[model samples]
Target: MEKKIITISRQFGSGGHEVGMKLAQKLGVKFYDKELVDMLAKDGKYNADFIEANEEKCSPPMCPVMPGFSMPVFYQDLPSDLIYKGQSKLIRTLAERGPCVVVGRCADYILRNMNPVNCFVYGSLEARVNRKMSMIPEGLSFTREEIKKRVIDVDKKRAKYHEFYTDKRWGRMEDYDLCVNTDKVGIEGAVETIAAYVEHCK
Candidate 1:
């Protein structure tokens, strides 16, 4: 029983990234996080930062208005939309290459057809705020309230992105094969659970 591919969709401050990385280490497989964005940016059509901004969130890719400006009639596809398409192809390609763990960027939805292990990581708002507060850089000034707001904001963006692209509700239990609450099992435990789930799968 080999873990061919694992895709993790997570809430903003839920330690999802850490879990994915650790699981990859435990499973001895390649891991893709921001690396996916870097690969997508290789052709130079989109920079790492640009892809980071629009890749995970829809920013309403199909909508004419998103954030700073509106798409003109001449521009058929928005930046976010193009980035999504690129990442979809890239994620699938990477999965095809070998076993790997991919974090965020809707990898689970993108890799759905591959029969990959799909996971969702999440925690309560207070738990997320606490975890996020500790991760903030030293000397950086940010209140717990600020961190909480940021967590909320990021989750909203992710939900929007998932729904727009997959036509499925984000955080919906049925969509994911496994859901872990970091508030309960913690990061390491979540990683172990996901790894075990992968092992349990065909």
Candidate 2:
């Protein structure tokens, strides 16, 4: 059987990363997440920290976070288009390398032609907040209202960033092979369900 690529687009605190990790382990394939930033940094000579800080988020005014800091202008400067171009290029490179489970980074649209198993993971506000609370460090504490607000803000930014980079609508069922509600089914259940779906796809 041909190796399959799995692209998981997930909401904040939805356990998408955990699910993706489990899926990769179950299938014995590599997983790509923040590792993508390191790969991009090596290929593009861009700073890894810079990429991580801005990964999957749009600049508010469409301005570079650090003025005048970017990859060397390849030819004519496509200033406005540079980050999107670089990010898309990086995503393409990773997908081409092997069968991997990619979390976020818009892998769905980036590898659209690769016959990837695309998934979207989301949950209700209360579920998401509870998950976030569990993941928080011991000393740091936040009210339920604060956690809920943070989740909304992060997901909003992700949606905006995805929309800005791709023509296809994000979170639409048509764009994905499977849409799992983490609230309805917990993380491990979501992972097992996806594993079964992947086997069927094969």
Candidate 3:
């Protein structure tokens, strides 16, 4: 049989990471999320911390964290582009090995040739805000309004990042094989539904 790969793209505050991790555990396969950052930085050319913060973000021409360092004017050779190239390579290697669940970094688009099952997870703003508040670091405190605004901001960055790399609008239902609204079905329901979709894949 062919490889079983699932790529999950999610809105900020959605439980896409949790869902993907659980799904991978349930399927007895490997999982990739922020781990991709460490892998990219493994060669030591890139800073792990910087890549972690900027991997899913889209800010052009210069480093977001380090203001002075700037990528060249050319789009293809931008810093994020370099990271995308590295990620695309690593993602392909992972998918080629066996069944796995990959979250973000435009893995769906990167592994399109491998025919991975691409899923998008989203939730209502209210649900997302609640989720985000619950998941916030213990030392950091955010008011409900603040969390809601941050949720929106994060989704915007994700969309921009995806478009920058893939030239496709993020969170569009048509681009994915399955789209789950976590607000409607909850995280477990979304996981179960996606699990079923993967099983049914030929």
Candidate 4:
């Protein structure tokens, strides 16, 4: 049987990671999300936090500013173009390795030629807010207002990044083979549905 690769693009609180992990387990293939970030961190010799901040941020082109605000200067150490290039290269390298489930970092667009089984996960705002609240780590005091703002901000950034890189609208059905709503089917159901889809593609 030929193996298939699945790429899931999702809203922040849509339980996409849970579904992807379950789907990867069922398909007996590797799952990548945070691990991909860690791999890039190791390979590029940069901290994971730095990679996370710079990963999907389509920053405006500008020379580095000095501490004293004396003048804007270009830094050879941090090339502006490297941010996108490095992340895109890492995503491609991972896909080239084998059949795997990759979440976020625009894997869908990066692997466009590979014909990956692409999916986009979304959910109702209420459902997403509730999920975000429940999933908040202990000691974190995030109100619904905060969660709502965060979700909107992240999705906006994702959309901007997608458009900047691929010139395609984000969260569009035409961009993916499957679109799953976690609110309708729940996390496990979404996983089963994707597993079925992956099997069908084989």
Q: 74-166 in candidate 3: lDDT tens per residue?
A: 344566667778888999998999889999999999999988899999988898988888888989988999988888988888898898888
Instruction: List the candidate numbers ranked by lDDT, top first.
Output: 1, 3, 4, 2
Better of 1 and 3 by TM-score: 1
lDDT of 4 by residue, 116-171 (tens): 99999999988998999998999989888999999889889888887877867889
Off by over 4 Å in 4: 64-81
Runs with alpha carbons beyond 4 Å of true place in candidate 3: 1-3, 62-76
- Report the Cα lDDT for residue 130, model 3: 89
Candidate structures ordered by TM-score, highest first: 1, 3, 4, 2
Cα lDDT computed for each candidate against the true fold: 0.87, 0.82, 0.86, 0.83
Best candidate (score: lDDT): 1
lDDT of 2 at 124: 86
Clashes of 3: 0
Candidate 1, 32-110: lDDT as tens digits: 9988888989978889989977777765334355566655444567777899899999989999999999998888888
Q: What is the lDDT of residue 140 in candidate 3?
A: 92
Each prediction's TM-score versus the true structure: 0.91, 0.85, 0.88, 0.87
Model 1: which residue pairs collide? none
**Count of backbone collisions in candidate 2:** 0
* Candidate 2 runs further than 4 Å off: 62-83
Candidate 2 residue-wise lDDT at 154: 92
C-alpha RMSD for every candidate? 3.7, 5.2, 4.5, 4.3
What is the RMSD, in Å, between candidate 2 and the native fold over all Cα? 5.2
